[model samples]
Target: MTFLTLLLQTPAAGGGFLQFLFPVAIGLVLYFFMIRPQQRKTAEAKSFRESLVKGTRVVTIGGLHGLLVEVGPETVLLEVERGQRLRFDRNAVARVAGNPAAEGATPTPNA
Candidate 1:
């Protein structure tokens, strides 16, 4: 059929550049909207883990909340209950227990 023949025909000369441009534009959109934000969030989490200090209240990725008794290079000792402590990896911390102001707050009140 004539319609089939027309559909099989190659695109116009000037349309070649447009074909490549569409995929490149899509790549840029994906990088900015998806990949870039994830990278930034990961960096922030890493920095927070590195800067952790003793006496800070924190929650782990497993939803366990505790007061940081000791912060080592790659591990942290958490006082989950009075006279009861557990050790976990630095990366296990999800975030500070409360707000920014609670960073240095007394652990007993929050824990």
Candidate 2:
């Protein structure tokens, strides 16, 4: 069969390594472009979460903005409105609020 003949053909001596090179090269590219950046961002988020203290304002994953009333080992109490407090997992704190510079520099809007 034609398929059997093609499979038995000898690779060119100079380019024989290309077959092995391509998949390894693609894997390296994927790690640098995708996996590495995600790991760095995750580490930054962990650092941000660990630095929290009482009285710091933050936004939750649910978009509820509040000041932190209490911080625990794995949870926090956030006061959303006057006399309205809700407990949330520490991971639910998306990011600290009111200081965009703390997360990253961004241009401010003007009207």
Q: lDDT of model 1 at residue 33?
A: 100
- Writing each residue's lDDT as its tens digit, candidate 2 over 5-56 gives 9878967566658988999999999999999999999999999899999999
Pairs that collide, model 1:
none
lDDT tens per residue, model 1, 12-34: 66677899999999999999999
Candidate 2, clashing residue pairs? none
Model 2: per-residue Cα lDDT at residue 69: 96
- Each model's C-alpha lDDT? 0.90, 0.90
Regions of model 2 farther than 4 Å from truth: 1-14, 99-111
For each candidate, give its TM-score against the true structure: 0.76, 0.76
How close to the true structure is residue 47 of candidate 1, measured as C-alpha lDDT?
Answer: 88
